[model samples]
Target chain A: MSETTEDIMSATYRALCAHGFADLTMQRIADETDRSKASLHYHYDTKEELLRAFLDYLLDDFESRLACEAADPDERLDTFVEAVFGPAEADDDGDFAVALLEIKARAPFSEPFRDRLVALDARMRETVAAAVRDGIEAGRYAEVDPDDVARFVVTAINGSHVREVALDESPAEARRLVEAYLDRTLDRRSEPEVPV
Target chain B: MSETTEDIMSATYRALCAHGFADLTMQRIADETDRSKASLHYHYDTKEELLRAFLDYLLDDFESRLACEAADPDERLDTFVEAVFGPAEADDDGDFAVALLEIKARAPFSEPFRDRLVALDARMRETVAAAVRDGIEAGRYAEVDPDDVARFVVTAINGSHVREVALDESPAEARRLVEAYLDRTLDRRSEPEVPV
Candidate 1:
């Protein structure tokens, strides 16, 4: 990104963090960047256009950081969980989660926002599903539908983030809970031992 | 509730469905109600105060509808699932899910909103936990931590709602996956037979 685009992106992030997606405006971003409104208009003609770019920036960064490749499928799954549930792992994500959620709330209304978020979700699901498929092939996990497993994992993780941001519950507890459940559900043994 | 409060709440719902939480204004609600803005102001001095009442109204209705008394724990669990996962069971919730999510997105920034949502979560956890405890006592479910089970269920359900609204995925699918997991994990039998 050019310095100007970089400055605007940072400014947008700050503005989002400060005022939230609902109250954000080009003027607010410009104020944060210490630049003229004309500077904002010079690059992006509208707030929606600018925010679309902002969402792309955040999602690209997230895809790279949270969904990296691993040698083993189990390792890939662990990496995804650790990256998501581990606090402060995503470059001050705690502060940005609310803002990100606010943008998602608008997804129902804005096709551009909706499409971007859908791509993000699809990418994350594919990442997790690929891990599950690899795990199955490697005999690390039992033979379960990879897409089903991935969808469940992604859905639960998505819910965990919302709970974390809205209800102040940690994804770590969710991680522990899901891990326990997955341990039993994904068992390759013919019989799952019931706890006495 | 008084007829006036009912009018305001219905107005709030329509306005939310039409404009969503971010753009909601008392004036817009008044327009929806076909009532004067003065009437809205007479009841709610500020939009924040009105929205607090709105959240209370929504949570109350949801509590009564989604979390209800059941004779059996399994039935209770099923009931909760049906209420949340079953489409259109929560009275046009399909229209309101996105709007409700928008309210929750603001919970991080608003104490009143956060408090109400937190209460909602606690109440749900208790309901599910109570059912699990009952199931254990009745020899219907295996010996397991009820709260742990309940927390997992609730977390997954919360996550499911976010996924449904943001990603257009169905909570019904999440329900199926969670049910399969719970069926194994909550087994009372000595062994859980594996399909493969």
Candidate 2:
């Protein structure tokens, strides 16, 4: 992202965190950055436009963030999964998840938002599938269909996160189950030392 | 549900499927039933109120439908899972799922919606847990934490459904993965000969 875009997105993130999705206004978003409302509007005309830009920024940021340097396929997959399930990246207060879910709920009605979300999920699914493919190629894991495994992993995490946001269900249990499933099915080549 | 309530719910279902959630109106709902808009208003003062009632009906309907006559634990568990994953109950075309997602997305902002969604999930979890418990009791499956398994199953289904609604992802793959996990972990005694 350009430096200016990054600055605006960071501010947008803070604004979203503070106001929640339902109450977010472009004015509030502009207030988080050095940009005046006029300047913000100059860059992105409408709140929907700004949000679509934010989603693009999010996709880019996620791709960059998932560039894990783990040594093995299993570990790489674990790291990828941990990026969401782990504390460092989880939307702790659920404000962010709620915000995303709200957007997701409306995606059916908005083509641009729908496209970005689809792209984002595609990235996640492909990244996972790549990791599984590597494991199979290296003979470090079972020869199960990589795409299928990736879909299952992604689906489980998606469900867990949604449940956590919607029902206040503990995501810790999901992490445990997912980890166990991976270890059992993949035959862990690198035992994760991450404490439960 | 009473005859009157069932009539209303069926109408509500048709309206939701036709209009989707965002455009749903009491008038549209009334158009689906014999009841006049005034009569509908007498029953539910607001669209939100009517939706809440519909959710309650859904819960009761779900509970009754899950009284699966499948003889064994594994078959019974499959039956319950099939309620969502199977063709018979799967929300084909996803209009209903999209509507629900819209409601679920706003659940955090509304207590009544949140409570009903939580209750619905709880019922799904407990039903799966009970099936697993029965399986263990009969020594037809390897012992595992029934609640844990139940949560995992529910989470995967939720994720798959959400993905299906939001990303137009296929849910058939999710069912395949979930079934494999259950058969492998639970040691299925009743071999489901259902064609995949």
Candidate 3:
């Protein structure tokens, strides 16, 4: 993993998150990572390259955690949602949530990053849809469009994190909201008497 | 309202959303508005103050549109949800949605803006809870915790916008998701069907 390169990339990602893409600079990242400017330049030729590395790192991490593992799909979906969107990790990371918020905002500006994100989202949806399809076949879930349900479920989970990060909501409140979302999402065995 | 101040603030807000808070400068804002930096500063002393003013402007606009005119609390709740979290404005003017997302990442550094957002959210929740309470009294909604339902509704609506903005989802999709959320929140009110 080239520890030095990884360190420099992580620092650059932090600077991009904390300050923003417009304020990012080699000097600032070097200062943050305690790496000399020449050393950083020797490792990464351009800021765009560094940015690409950052996205690749994140996508790799997410895929390794969510998609590349063997486990029950239902439990995997739960784990995936909790790992991606839960505020439980905020205790250890100073502002990872804020960084994610900034990254999502910057997504529209970079075609490569935007395409990667869309592809990743589609992969996650497919995984969840397959799980829901199995659940329906096994009579674990009632008849429903797996694609639509998967979209809503994933959106709700991801959306909760965005809300918490954007609103600076308390972790306790975030957990409560996530629980509420899960209850509704899992209670899909049959439709309520009312129409949505 | 001071037209000159409004113009500068509006342009500054737009630049912040288009660029970011860390990248915003009085000069760039003035350039966008076709005003001199001195003229812009004459209206706003510092960038921080200008940022505060822009935030206040959004709060004021939201309050005016959703908070002031509705005689019925339920109508107010519906209007607030529709206006704040509904489709991107028919016009190109980026409203509170973009500004809030852009500025929110900086909240950890600014107590005033963070506090204002929290208070604004609380006010909105109270309005929605009141509406839910009235609905319950009128038998339009089932017995449920109004506060919880209000919080869920607000978070879901705010969260949906992030996906909507990224996916360019249609207004119909937003309506469908919101309706599903509301249906689940009101599920307790539906009459249970008897087995044939």
Q: What order do candidates take by TM-score, descending?
A: 2, 1, 3
Among incorrect, acceptable, medium and high, the docking class of model 2 is: medium
DockQ of 3: 0.39
What does the lDDT read for residue A151 in candidate 2?
79
**Sort order, lDDT high to low:** 2, 1, 3
Q: lDDT tens digits, residues B148-170, model 2?
A: 88988999998987887778777
Per-model RMSD to reference: 4.6, 3.9, 5.6
For B1-196, candidate 1 gives per-residue lDDT tens digits of: 9998988998898888777777788889999886899989998899999999998987787677776556877778777777667665345656678888988888887999999999989988888889889888988898999999888888878878887787777667889987876776678443546899
Q: Which residues of candidate 2, in runs, are more than 4 Å off?
A: A88-92, A189-196, B87-92, B189-196
Q: What is the lDDT of residue B58 in candidate 3?
A: 72
Model 1, runs deviating above 4 Å: A1-7, A31-37, A66-69, A88-93, A188-196, B32-35, B66-69, B87-93, B188-196
Clashing pairs in 3: none
Per-candidate DockQ values are: 0.71, 0.71, 0.39
